[model samples]
Target: KAAYNKYLSDKRAKSTRAYIISQGIDPKRIESAIGYGEERLLNGCDGSIKCTSAQHQLNRRSEFIIVDM
Candidate 1:
């Protein structure tokens, strides 16, 4: 499950990056796109804890960090 989750997150990140470029954003502007799957959980939803579907969904998200204006 861990490996699969990582793979899915990585794919999502790459797809998001592609989408940004498709929208006319310069690819060079993106230094790197990485997926830290399950590494950072928003609501502390882990394997040992019982989390609601909504909580799990929250962890499965994409976040963008603006490095420059």
Candidate 2:
């Protein structure tokens, strides 16, 4: 989970920084964004836990926020 979170965080931060720069925001003026991954599961464990790990992982995701600089 930690590794996944780190990976997603890096991904989101890079993407956000690129977008901000592309929109004419100064690179140095912008701070980094953070990604929250898989921590907020929407579906409560419905029925059996027999679903494949890959299925559960599909729920795992990345989220991002822009730092106010």
Candidate 3:
């Protein structure tokens, strides 16, 4: 699970960052592409327990968290 989680996270983060850049987000303003993997869950989904597919799907996601630099 850890390996797969990392793989997906890396893939998602890279593609997302690239897309953002291609869309004209200033490169200097961009910080870094961060892959959190399965570390942070937005909902109640865990590998140790059973969860609906929808719940698990929510865990596999990415977001751009901007902060003042």
Best by lDDT: 1
For model 2, the superposed segments whose C-alpha errors exceed 4 Å read 33-69
lDDT string for model 2 (1-46, tens) is: 5567667756876787788689997777754555555445545422
Q: RMSD to native for every prediction?
A: 0.9, 5.6, 1.9
RMSD of 2: 5.6
What's the TM-score of each model vs. the native? 0.91, 0.44, 0.81
Consecutive 10-residue window with the lowest summed lDDT within model 1: 39-48
- Global lDDT of model 3: 0.82
Higher-lDDT candidate of 1 and 2: 1
Of candidates 2 and 1, the better by TM-score: 1
Query: Which pairs, if any, clash in model 1?
Result: none
Clashes of 2: 0
Give the residue spans of candidate 3 off by over 4 A: none
Please tell me which model should have the higher TM-score, number 1 or number 3: 1
Ranking by lDDT: 1, 3, 2
